[model samples]
Target chain A: MDMRAAVFRGPGEIAIEDVPKPALDAPTDAVVRVTHTAICGSDLWPYRGQEDRDVPSRIGHEPMGIVEEVGEEVRSVAPGDRVFAPFVTSCGECEFCRKGLHTSCVNGGFWGGEDGGAQGEYVRARHADGTLVRVPDRHADDEETLQAILPLTDVMGTGHHAAVSAGVDAGSTCIVVGDGAVGLCGVLAARRLGAERIIAMGHHEDRLALAESFGATDTIAARGEEAVERAQELTYGGANHVMECVGSTGAMNTAIEVCRPGGTVGYVGVPHGIEDDGLDIFGLFMDNISLNGGIAPVRAYADELLADVLGGTLDPSPIFTKTVDLDGVPEGYRAMDEREAIKVLVKP
Target chain B: MDMRAAVFRGPGEIAIEDVPKPALDAPTDAVVRVTHTAICGSDLWPYRGQEDRDVPSRIGHEPMGIVEEVGEEVRSVAPGDRVFAPFVTSCGECEFCRKGLHTSCVNGGFWGGEDGGAQGEYVRARHADGTLVRVPDRHADDEETLQAILPLTDVMGTGHHAAVSAGVDAGSTCIVVGDGAVGLCGVLAARRLGAERIIAMGHHEDRLALAESFGATDTIAARGEEAVERAQELTYGGANHVMECVGSTGAMNTAIEVCRPGGTVGYVGVPHGIEDDGLDIFGLFMDNISLNGGIAPVRAYADELLADVLGGTLDPSPIFTKTVDLDGVPEGYRAMDEREAIKVLVKP
Candidate 1:
């Protein structure tokens, strides 16, 4: 069967084109008819040619949809069930997956990088039982709720991972370094996790406002040393937990500088400019700071975050400042790249 | 009163000379008449001229001795008490000290770097209640026990810090990246923490044997990729906890390469060659590994470690392969720098 999907032709080029609908390739697979999807900061990496890719490939990994078909072995999810698919697909039974580090699952792979992308009208999900979370009945028919849920696939989950990895908990003083959707999401996550003081550092006033609304106790519209100085002044010395959501070297350094001695920097930005050099080992060692983080195990955190979403306590949809259909995804990418929108959502 | 002490004349130079005996400088200070002290691997930094120093400075930080006098405010210790002083002096009431991170205490200072060194007839200890741990009665009168206890002030405690910072616990597979005294002590610390398998990597057979004696289950006398390969082969992939006890770039890289995805590298070797270049941040981020550690908070761990020593469960004295009087310290530094001794004990 034919379906409409977003295809990446090259850097700065994406087109909605006719594609073959995905079918259940294995007994553990399920095909979902995408209802909503969104653009991610990571999607811009390949779009901007920062990350190399094969041309004319499927694009996008953040999608919420209704299961259209399931193989005989798929017992937990079935046709007509509304669900959220994590960016990474996992087998659920590997040592890493069983330990709740689904991102490191032995048999896991990314939605677009290793398999078919989720921007299509219908996409096949492998390890269906372990990769998809069912949407509750109360929010099943609500488009806004579904739009908010879309980000949990990658951005929100990733931000949550950053906060948790940095040890942001009750009484923690945290500073998030970035003004993007994920950074805003991180502010929300830190608040949810009970951080006592949340400092959001960014240049854009609009995004900073969004951050404050999402529970940032303070905002510093500065970069580099000034941002670090502001954070240090706000926290008396430096924050106990720092979240680096921008992959730039300066942002990473700022995160490190603004962290208190014995603090942790949880980095979730897909690193781009840090190939030739690493962080200052001597400085980090002298401060007794810890550097930790990676791609979020979204599958592991989806259920708990979903509880907060369904409970009506979280409304992350405000991050979707722009909306587009499958055909307008090209413009959606441009809007995000140009900083005109924090995130863009698509209704297929 | 005049007393003899070792003084650093310049790089690669030391001399025994008469100096005024230390007097209590603060209300919380105590004067220790040096009975036993040891040279540290860190001491070689200046002795070998790798590190610059101000001429004519006292030069040591690891010492244990009889408490000759205590300031009026000192409550926990008094004259005649035998104690082990940590390398860092901290005010017990500071936030960092109260949190058990004495090394980062607001009013903390390095014994040798910021104050008078320990290889002297008498040394003043600030914040005595927080920086010094009293030696048990049975071990106080025994010179052999005192020699064993001396290492806990720095080398052994630093190694223990590496293990703990790397999250070494029961059943963990660990690797120690150097075979120096501190690395050998790391093997002991890992074993004490219940690590299932301890791999000690180095080129020296003598130090490797000592590592095995200290509880290393495996030893790899190789460097770089060969070291990583051997570690991978033993752990089936990579070690869960890696203790980086060598500050060399090659050893640090090997430590990073041999760590399992999601594992940690606890580095305690005062970083030297890593100033211009850092670790591979992209690689570390992708692998989900964490880097943590710093100078050991010996004061925090000294009491617990001393219990193991007095209980006869640990004997770290073998690390002191040579002994010298105060006048022989210059030769002791030369012996250590020339690789003739693992560590040197100084009887003042």
Candidate 2:
């Protein structure tokens, strides 16, 4: 069988191509019909030529869909079950997976590697039992509910991981660095974790407003030293918890600078220019600022975040400001990269 | 009156010179006649010409002494009280201090600046009530008790900070890097915190032996790649809690390399060549390793560690392998620089 999938040709180029449709290649694998997918800020890295990638690579990772077929070993989801997989697939019982570090699972892999691209009609999930999350059948046809929980496959769980790493607790103050979907999700996650003061730093006025609605007590559209000063002034020195959603060296430094002594900076930002510039580690060591977080173990947090979404208490759907079909994925990438869209959702 | 104090003549030189005796300089000041002091690994930076400093400057910060005089506002101790001061003098009531970040206290200053050098017979204490911790009158004149508590002024407290920063918990495993007095004390601290397994890494055989007595379950004196391999082999990948007590760039890298995913590296090492070599922050991010710790908040941990010391469960005094009188201050520097002594104890 053949299916339409988004393929990355090179920088600034994504194309729709007919690729082999995902099938249950292993007993632990399940084939999914992707009803929804998303264009992430991370995707823009390759599109903008900031990160290197092999040409003709399968594109996209976040996927929400129906299980088209499941292998004999896939027990959790049956055909026609509405399911979503995390950014990475992993064997449920690996030492790391058992310890909630699924990102480091011994048998884990990304969606666009051996599996079909997420922005496709069909995708394959390896280690299906450990990777797939089933939504209640009652919400199978609910478009509103599906839209609300789509970000949970990546950004929401990632934001929650940032909050957890930063030690955001009841009555704690926090500063979220970035204006992207993940950063907005961080504000929501901080709120969910009972943070009393969520100060958001971003450059977009519209996004800053969105952050406030997402439960940020304050928002500042500043960069560099000014951003640090404003955040510190608001927190009466610096916030104890900071989230770095942007991977730039400047964002990392701001996250650290706005973190108070004995505080923590939870950074889920994938390093961009860090290899070239390095981090101000001596500064981090001197100030007692704990730098925590890396690639979020998004799978480990799925159940809890899904529960919140199902309960109708969490809504991250507003981040999907643009919608597209499989053919629109190239445009989706362009929209996100040009800041014309906060995040683009694809209905395949 | 004049007091003999150790002064930094430059790299590879320490000279004892008579300086005017310290007196109460502020309303909160206390003048202490030094009874005991010790050389810190940090002090060697200037002695080895690794760190820049003004020549002929006063040296030494850790001091245990008898309070000879007190200004009117000093409420914690009166004349004739036996006390010890942390490396940095902080006004305990400051925002950072009240939260147990005394090292970042707004009114904090180092002992050898403005105040008198701790290596001198007399040193003036600023923010006396907040900076000085008094020993019980019963144990005041006991030589054994005095020696047992002297390291609390610096190394012991420092090691304790590392354990706390590393989040050492009951039934956890830990790896302490370095064989200095602080590293030995870190082994003790981890044991005190109920870590089930403690691995000590260093280059010295005698110090590793000391670490064993201090509760290290394993000791590996390897460096670089071999060090990482041996530690990983012993720890089943890597321990979740690693304490970097050695300030060298190589030690920091080893600490990071040996920390497991979702683990933390509690670094108390005053970074030596990090500015030049830089840290592999991207690697840390990729591994999900958290970097926690800075200059230890020694004063913040004094009370709890002191109680443990007085309870006969902890004995870190063994780290002081050699003791010298006031005139042996120059030799004390040489012995530590040459690693002839784990730490040098000075009595004036």
TM-score of candidate 1 versus the correct structure, residues matched by position: 0.92
Q: Where does candidate 2 chain A have its weakest 10-residue lDDT segment?
A: A274-283
lDDT of 2 at B276: 72
Task: State each model's CA lDDT, in order.
Answer: 0.86, 0.90
RMSD list, candidates in order: 2.8, 2.0
Cα shift from native, residue A154, model 2 (Å): 0.6
Candidate 2 lDDT by residue in tens digits, A206-304: 999999999999999987888889998999889889999988888998898899888999999888987567677767877889999999999999999
Model 2 segments more than 4 A misplaced? none
Could you tell me every candidate's TM-score relative to the true structure?
Answer: 0.92, 0.95
Model 1 interface CAPRI class: medium
DockQ winner among the candidates? 2
Tell the DockQ for candidate 2: 0.61
